[model samples]
Target: MESSSEFPTSPSSGTTAITNPGFPVSDTVLSGASLPSPPERTSSQGGGIPLSKTASNVSSHSHRQSFAENQRHPPPSPRTQRHPSFTQQAIQDLMNHPPPNRHQNPRYVGRDWRDVAVGELLQPDEVKWAELDMSIQEATKTLFQSSPNNVVLVRQDSSSKEAMSTFDHSDLNAYLLAVVGLAKPEEEQVALYRDISVKAQSQEEIPLRDLQPIFRKEELVKIPAESTLDKAIEVFGGGVHRILVTNKDSEVVGILSQLRLLEFFWNEAVNFPLIDRLYTIVLRDLQIGTQQIIAVNADAPLADALFLMSSEGLTSVAVVDNGHNVVGNISTVDVRHLTNANSLPLLKASCMHFISVILSERGVEHGRDSFPVFYVNPYSTLAHTVAKLVATQSHRMWVVESASPSPSAPATPLLQASSSLPPLSTLSPPAISPGRTGSPTPGSATVVVPPPGAITTSTPQSPSTQGPFSSVPASALPGAGLSGRLTGVVSLTDILNLFAKSSGLRPLDPSEQRARRRRSSSSSVRPTLDIGRENGRGSVDSRR
Candidate 1:
């Protein structure tokens, strides 16, 4: 059952400064949302699965498991500082060349990031496609997508010396994509999501299971359904654009996402205190999604999901069970099969526990929904909510419709499961009877993707440096392993694509291509043939 001891928030205490590991800290700090992991074998000893980002060591912290048993969550870690010099220089370089567009500028006076979406900020070229996990798309009946936020330039050589590094704004987009779900994590790439959520309660690092999970009790900001825009302005301060439309049960009926208020007050409305205009920005006005939800079964392949995201566009998607209530969601670049689906029978002993924990969380299944998921009671405070998000470094949450719906048998052992995510057995597809249109819709199909090749992914111990992978060219990887799971190395090609798009430097058209007769060609500048939609809207849009 949900708790009803309403905990409402007061205004924020504002930003505070804190120190990082050698990095200067300010009140405006950010961190990763990941979980802890078990011990890892050193890469130097032999070929082992690369570490998951959120890995940790567990043997010393037996007492900590009880903390997690109590539902205390972990906190996400701040971005790591262990990058080579090249990576650092790249970041500084991007800071130097800022976008000129008022809408695209990250630091425009009075502008807040939460208030905007990529559609408003992205150039035509800037909008690259990403794949959605099958669960997210099928559960929501929408193609989920995100644009890259940042692109880091890493230079590695045989001598093990770091080369010149640069960070481009484009890189930032890629980072955002990874953060939200537009990009996929490399297989064995360890990322700490909520460093705090699954970390040892003690200050020192510990194994994932040993982390004392803390679910804080904090006040939240709640808006009554009847509250007016003018009234909301007085309460939320400068950026309170919209309010949540909730019912008497405190269930959200709709919301006034910031975009809602912007449409009404864009250029013409009187400039009132933003808090005041908040209430009237109804959920109906701000709904950025469509009515028809498209979804795939949880077992579906991520490649299928990515095809959906890249072709369709999505921000976040709702995961649903057979009953159709939303359970979870997946976003951005975290949906890679390499990192999330390495079925090595037993994960690499060298692969750290924290990263595995993150991997487990990243690919969790909520009943049958395709998206990864996490949960909280309906009554947690906003502060509690924020704490949970901060701890896990995940932006979305799942408030199970029924708090005491079901309980499971006590966990028997660790080997029974890889990470802490529920074993795949519990996941099942949502049930939807077919409409007159056709074959079984997305929900009817099984979306299970084949697990990745052996998790102890390493090349054969041959004299030549080329590993087993080198022996099998991407084209001959049996199925889709090569193109689908190649984040192991970052190439200049990916970086080039990122920069060109951010700058809106498009290529020529087919006619233009022929006329110039040049060497290089552009993606946006393509041989134009109609790849119009199956829907007839393409024939006569007045906007065109």
Candidate 2:
């Protein structure tokens, strides 16, 4: 990595923007870009002028989170990665540091505010793919020694882009996360599947216009220009994790996140490394390693979303309406109470809830549980991905590429994880192992690995078949079918999960990536928690 002096110090200032890195960074933005006005808000959609960012702030036994909900939507691209002065050396320093430790943590002690630039150290692009595809085990045991969930991603751009995710309904998925059916007293799995049946029976899908607006730009909060991190949070309430930085024309130019702000307080041994003092990187080449986004549309038929959660396997989605603005958020937890297993057999006819249970959190062999979506720009380093989880409290983040011509960007798994995925037959649900034979899988299916091009665009009949981000089997379930162009139904939220499967969020096998790491260690700064405490802290785990 090289070094530079042009990086922006504040999250909301005029910095580079975040861009989708899935496509080549050098690739120009698709030609027809224009300012599309927000569509009209719908009836079922109530408006509170967007809640004060703090109003929606969710607090828990150990953590607290809030962000500006009404903040304007910044342009898809951020200025952080595009600044003229951002260089490779700065990016290296950012990558070397983990999220929680990047900023000189005011919550704890030790470390300097000057050296504690929260979002700097980023991983080189060459190692990015290796990091995301590593399994949870590999990420924790090898790549980073922090809580397997708290590493960060670093980028090559001098902008020092940072990313992370937040859980909308973390509790909903927690119960089913670790325990298996054998924990009878806690045997909530099957019952959980049955509860899904109840929710479906009572709700129905509606048009996008029927939702309520969550927050409007500045309606709930304000981001003072380059403001101190603490003040920013209070003004935003707690929900404003990311604040959009727009230009005089109200055109979005950049963004600031709560996680990034928090980084200002924590610091340790994390530092950037570089072979040279300066190098230029493109916007796509610089971005947060993990991204967290929320989807909500108040008018959505509760049943439709529940089915979506299970079928697509998402923890939560930031629902929106016709105008492309977020509405009241719904999460896995909302659907859980609706799909209670005890309520399933009672109704007997609620097939929707039954299948939802099978889908929401279950995996092929065993239910892997649900996770909040992490948004990524595709250009972050392995270190960035690790850091995002820690600062934002997440295990995974979704990577969004460019926006589509707008009716809405369908969540189609259009891209490939790599060129080596197995055949679609191998990916078939029925082919899944006996370990899950009795599980409440939505379609009672087993998926075998499929060929690389199994779901390519050559087959035009695949309405709703998102190219690479979200791939719905031509027929995932019996009645879960679609019509033309799949429109809003094929949302990026759910499609992102499918993309994870295709893009290799969890590599089927990563011995190779691990081997590559060993070989490159001499030249790279692979920070490890295994060594011991940094300064004033207890053992690493206890301190964190």
Question: What lDDT score belongs to each candidate, Candidate 1 first?
Answer: 0.25, 0.26
The estimated TM-scores of all candidates read 0.25, 0.24
**Candidate 2 segments exceeding 4 Å error:** 1-111, 114-283, 287-397, 407-437, 440-544
Candidate 1, TM-score vs. the true structure? 0.25
- How good is model 2 by TM-score? 0.24
lDDT of 1 at 174: 25
- Residues 1-544, candidate 1: write the lDDT tens digits: 0010101112225411111112111111122112222234332223223454565674434423454444444332222212213422332232222222314223333543233322232233321121211222121111111212221211232222221121222222222223223233223322332222122112232221211111010112234444443333322222221233444554333434333333223321222233223223322232211123443322232222332432233222333322333323333333321221222221112111212222232222211101112343333332233333333333233443232222110110111222222222122212223541111222222222222232433322211111111121112212111111110111111122222232333312222322222211111111111112222111211110
Look at candidate 1 and tell me the lDDT of residue 86: 40
lDDT of model 2, residue 492: 19
Worst 10 residues of 2 by lDDT: 208-217
Tens digits of per-residue lDDT, candidate 2, 1-544, equal: 0011111112234322221222111100111112223344443222334334465544342231223432343323322233221233333355434434334334333533223322232212312111223222222122222221122232223243321111122212222221111111123334432332232233322111111111011111223233332333332222223343323333223344433343322233232122011112211443222222323222333333443343333444433332222222234533233222332221122222222322222211121211122333234443443343333343233343421112111121111112222211111111223654232322211112122224434321211211112222323322122111111221211222222332233311222322332232122122221111133111212110
